[model samples]
Target: MMRTIMAIVAAGLAAVAVQAAGPGFDPRALKAVAGPPNEVMVLGTPHLSGWPKDFDAKALGPLIDRLAAWKPQSIAVESLSGLQCDALRRAPFRYAETVETYCWDATPARQATGLDVPAATAEVERRLAAWPERPTASDRRHMAALFLAAEDQGSALVQWLRLDGADRHAGDGLDTVLVARLETLRQRRNEEFLIAAPLAARLGLERLEPMDDHSADRPYRNAEEEKAAGAAIMKAWDNAATARRKAADAALQSGIKTGAGVLALYRAYNAPEQAQTIYDSDFGAALKEPSPERFGRGYAGYWEVRNLRMAANIRDVFAAAPGQRMLVIVGASHKFYLQAYLDMMHDVRLVDTDAVLR
Candidate 1:
C-alpha cells in the first residue's frame, strides 16, 4: 500500500511539472512581429486631495514640465468616464453606492445645454470628428460646455485651460453658472484637475480620457460583516511593513514645499521596490488574514477586479490608434497592477517611469 501511494504522488508531481512547462500563448512574444509598438508610461501619484490644505499647486511644476517633454499623444486620468457613470446610475440595484460615491450629477449642466448624458456624449463625438486644425475661442467654449453637460469635468477643464483667459467667460453655450463651475474646477486640488488637465492643455491635446472603474464596488452583507471585515483588514495592516510604508510617506510629504521635493516624492512612489512594499503592507497582508469569513480575500479580489477593469478601460482608449504614446496617471497602489496587465498587450512597450522622471 505504501509503495502504491508513493508512486501515485510521484505521478501527480510529474503531471504538475508538465503542465507548468506546457506551450503557452504570450502576447508579449508577438511584439517583435507587430507594427510600431505603443509606448505607455504609468505614473503613480498620491491623490492630491489627501494632501494638506496648504499645499500649493505650483509645487507640481517641475513634474509637469518633465511629463510635457515626453509629449504623450494621449493622457488617461483616474476618473470615471461620464458614460460609465451614466450606466451606473441606471443600475441602482447593483451600483447605488458606487454611483453615489463617484458619479457627478450633471443636472445643472444638462439644464444649461438641453442635452442629457447620451446626447451630450454623442454631440462631443460629432464635434471632435469635425474638429478643425485651428478651433476658435468660441469653438473651445462650446466644447467645454458640451463636456460639462456630458459630466466630464476633466475634459471640460482641458478646453477651459487651452483657451486664452479673455475667452474663458459665459458665452457660446456656457452660462454664467457653468463658467463659475469651470473656475471652481480649475482651483480644485485633485490631480485630474491640477496635473492631467493642465498637461493635456499644454501638450495641445483635445481631451483627457477617464479610465477609472468602480464596477466591482459592492456593499457588505450586514453591519456585523462590515465591521468584522474592517477590523480584520486593520489588524493585518498593523505589521512592520505598514509602519515602514507610513514612515516613508510621511518623510516624503514633509518635503513637498518645493517642486524638487514634490518630484522626489513622486520618484519614491514609483520606485521599482514599491510594488513589493505595497503588497507586503496592504494586499499581501489582507490575503493572509485568519478570518473565517475570508473578508481579506474578498477585499483583495475586489482590488484586483478594479485594477483589471481600469487596465481594460485604458487599453480601449488607445486601441483604435495603434502605436500612440500614452500616459496614465493613477494612484500609486495601482501602478504595479496596471503595468503588469498592460505589459501583456501584444504591441505595448512600457516606458520606465524612473527614466521619464529623470
Candidate 2:
C-alpha cells in the first residue's frame, strides 16, 4: 500500500512539473523568450500632482534628462486632443512662437519673505547640476528653454488669472478680461505643450495625440444646466476620489506593504468600476449636458474607442520612415491602459520602469 501511495505522489509531481511548463516551453531547455512581433515598450507616468509644487526643476530635470538619454524613437504624451488639437494646429498662424526667455518668479512662500530671484534660480540650478547623467546638449538646451518660458512673468500672471477658483477682479483692465486671460493661458499652455512635443517629433514618434478635448466654453453658456451637471459630476467625482483615497489609505494602513505608489497605481487601474458607478450616479447625468465631466468622460472614452491607435499611429509613421525609435508623452493615468492594450499586439517590448528609473 505504501509503495502504491509513493507511486501516486511521484506521478502527481511529474504532472505538476509538466503543467508548470506553459505554452512555448522548450522540451530541451524548458524556456521561452520572445513574444509576438507587435509588442512595444510602455511606461506609466505618475501625474506631477504638484507638477511645480512638491518637486521642482531639480527633480524633473534629471528624470527627463535620463529619459532623453535612453533615445526612445517615439515619445507619446498625455496632452491635447480633438478640438483642442484643431485649435493648437491653428495657433502658429495666429501667434508668434517668440524667442524664449526665463525670469525668476518666487512662490508666495518665498515672495512673502522677499527672496531674491537669483537665490531661487540658484536652488533650481543646484538641483539640476546634481543629475547623475549629464544631460545631452540638446536636452540641456530644451531645459533652458523651458526654464525661460516658465519664468516669463507676463505669462505667469496670465496663468494665475486662469486658475479655476481664483477670485474675480472688480474693475481689472482688458488684460484681466476672461477672454483675454483665456487666450494668454491657452498660448502659455501650448508653449508648455511644446516641451514634450518637438522632442517626440524629433525621435520620429508615430505622432503625438491628446487624451481629450477641452470644453472651456460650454460651462458658462447654459448656466442652469451647467451648474446642475457640474454639481452632480463634482459630487460623484468627489465621492469616487474619496473612495479611491480611502482604499489607498487602507492599503497603506495595512502592515503588509510593498511600494505605496505601486499600490496606488493598482487602485487607479481597478477604478473603472468606480468610474462606471460615477457615470451611473446623478453626477454622470448632470455632466451629460453642459458639465465638464461629460468632456472628461468623452475624453477618456476616445482613448478606449481608438484602442491601440498609438501603435497603429506608430506603425503608420514607421511605414513612412522605418527603423526609428518612438516616444509617447501621455499623462500618467493612461499608461496602465496603454500598456495593456499595447501588450495584446505582437512583437512589442515594454521598457521596464524599475530598470529605467533605478
Candidate 3:
C-alpha cells in the first residue's frame, strides 16, 4: 500500500511539472501548440450597400453592437488578400472604383490626414507597431482614414494587425473620430460597409482576414461557350431558390435591428442541412450537363475550388493564434460552405449563430 501511494504521488508530481514546463493545457487544443479552441461566429449578411437608396444603416446598428459584445480577437471578412493584393496593385484605379461601388469613398480622410495610399500604409504600419493600450482620438482617426487610403483598403488591415485586436470606438456621425466614409470602405460589398467593418473599426482591430478567394475561376473554351453554359445553368434555376433567398434577406433586413431575427437568419444560413438545399436548388442546374462539353461541371468545379481555397485561407488565420475568437462576415450564400469547411478544422469551434443571435 505504501509503494502504490508513492507511485501515485510521483505520477501526479510529474504531470504537474510537465504542464508547468510546457505551455498550460488548453481544452480547445486538438494538437500540440495549436492553442485553445478558437471561437468562431460567421455572420451571413446581405449586400446592403447594393440595396435601394432608402437602405437604413442605422437599423443595422444594434446587430453590430451585439456582435461587438462577443469581444472577438479576430474578424475575417469575405475579401481577397495575398495574391489578390498583387492583382489590385496592377490595377490601382480599381482600388478607388471598388470603394465607390462597394463602399462610400471618404474624401474627407484624404483632406483630413493628407496621406495617400503609400504614405498612409507606411504611417499606419509605423504607428501600429508602437500603439499604446489606449489610443488617442487622433490615433484612431488617422487609422480610420487609412482604411480609405490603402490600394484595396489594405491599410485598415495593416492597422488591425498592429493594434493586437483592441476594440476601437471612434464615436458616431461627424463627432465620430474615424471618417464614416473610410469605415464604410472596410465593409466589403455592403456587408462590411454597414456592419462588419464598423465593428472592426470600433474595436480598433488592426486588420481583417481577407478570406474570399477567386483565383480558381478561369474562362471556358470561349466566351460563347461560357455564355451558353451560363444560360443553361440559369434556365435550370427557375428562380425558385433565388427568389426565396432574396425574400428571406428582405425579411431579415426588416428586423435587423432586433438581433433575434438576424440571428435566426444566420442559424438557418449555416445549418448543415442547408448544403443539400443549395445543390438541389441554387446549383441544381449549375452542375448538370448544360452543354456536351461539361459546362455545368465547369461552373461547379470553379465554385468548389473557390470555396476550398477560401476555407484554407480562413483556416490559416488560426495558426497564429489558436485561442482567438473569430467573426466571419460573408455573403449569405457563403455561410454554409464556409461553416462546413471550418467545421473540419481541429482547432476551430464554430459558435452557433442561433445561440449568438439569441
Candidate 4:
C-alpha cells in the first residue's frame, strides 16, 4: 500500500513537470506586444564582463540595441533600496552596485583601490588557466559551481574551504592556489544554491535591483534571544542539508543528465519556492540574517512559503494595476519556477527571458 501511494504521488509529480515545461510554449508568445503585456519582462542577464571568445560585447551589442529599441517604460535594476533611495530621476545608475561593473572590466573599484585593474579581475582566469585542456563536462560544471560560489560567499569561500579540509596549496603563486583551493571548497560545499539568485538577475528583462537586505549582525540588544535564535537556525540548516543530500542522491539515481534536468529534479523534489524563501528569509535583531530553515532556521523561515508569497505578491501587484507593462527583476534560478507559478494564473502573458537576452 505504501509503495502504491508513493507511485501515485510520483506519477502526479511527473504530470506536473510535463505540464510545466513541455508543449504549449509558443515562440510567437515571445514577441513584443503592442505594449507590455500583463506580465513583466524577465531577462536572464550575465553579470560577468568577459565571455568566452564567442560571447564578447561586440557579439552582445546587437542584443542590447534590440532591448533598448523595445523601450521598456523603466528598466528596473537589482539595487538595494537604501542604495537607490534617491529620486528615480536622480538615480545615477540603472544596475545595482553589485552588478555595476558589467559593461567593462573592474573600472572604478580597481582604480580607486589602486589595485591592478586586470589583477583585480576574478580569479576565474587563474581557474581557467589551472584547468586541464579540454575539460570534461563534469569539470566545467564543477568549475562553474566554484566560480559562482566564490562570488556568492565572497571571501568566505576561502575560509570555509579550509574548514572543509581541502588542502591549501602553498607553493608558488599561492594566491592562485588559494583561489583554486577556495573554488574547490565551494564545489564541495554546494554552490548551486548561490547561482539561482544571480541567474534570475541575468534573465530579468531590465537591470537588476536588490530586492532584499543581506546585512550581518552588529551589537545586539538581546544577546540571549540572539543565541537561542542562532541555535534554532543552525538546526534548520542541518535539516536542509540532509534533505539536499537525499535530493542529490535521488537525482543521480534517476539519471538526471542535463543541468535543466538537475534543476527540475531540484524543483520537483526540493521545492525551489521554499529554497528561495531561505534566500530571502530575514531574522530580527535576535536572529540576524537569512538562514536555511531546514538546516538552521535561524531567521530565514521555510523558503517554499516565502517564494509563494513573493509570487503571489508579484501576481497581485500586476493584477492590481492592469494593462501596465511591468518588468520584475528576480534571480535567474527563480525564472523557471516563477514561470510555473505565473502559468497557473489567468489573464497573464509570460515572456521568455531567452528572447530578450539573445
Q: Candidate 1: lDDT of 257?
A: 88
Tell me the tens digit of each residue's lDDT in model 1 across 80-199.
Answer: 989999998988888998888888898889998999999999999999999999999999999999999998999999999999998889988899999999999999999999999999
Q: Over 4 Å off in model 1, which ranges?
A: 1-11, 14-23
Cα TM-score of candidate 3: 0.68
- Candidate 1, poorest ten consecutive residues by summed lDDT: 28-37
Best-first order by TM-score: 1, 3, 2, 4
**Candidate 1 TM-score versus the reference:** 0.95
| lDDT by residue (tens digit), candidate 2, 147-168 | 2222323222322332333333
TM-score of 4: 0.31
The worst-scoring run of ten residues by lDDT in candidate 2 lies at: 95-104
By TM-score, the best candidate is: 1
List the RMSD of every prediction in angstroms: 1.9, 17.7, 13.7, 18.7
- Model 3, 203-314: lDDT tens per residue? 7676666688766544455678868877877776766666776676677566555445555555566666666766677666577545676666777777778788887887
Regions of candidate 4 where Cα sits further than 4 Å from its true position: 1-37, 49-60, 69-71, 83-302, 309-313, 316-320, 356-358
Against the reference, the lDDT scores of all candidates come to 0.93, 0.40, 0.63, 0.40
Q: In order, how many clashes per candidate?
A: 0, 37, 15, 40
Which lDDT tens digits does candidate 4 get at residues 1-358?
Answer: 9999999999999999988896666543453545446756654332322212222223233444444544443333332232222222133343333234222222222333333323322444476557564544344333333332333222223223322233433322234434454455433312211232223223332112223222221222366766765676554445444566457546543533344433343334333344443333322221433443322332234343444554565666566556655445454445545556666666466665445443
Segments in model 3 whose C-alpha atoms lie over 4 Å from true places: 1-35, 88-127, 141-149, 152-189, 239-273
lDDT measured at residue 130 in model 3 versus the true structure, 0 to 100: 93
Off by over 4 Å in 2: 1-39, 46-50, 53-55, 80-221, 240-303, 306-315
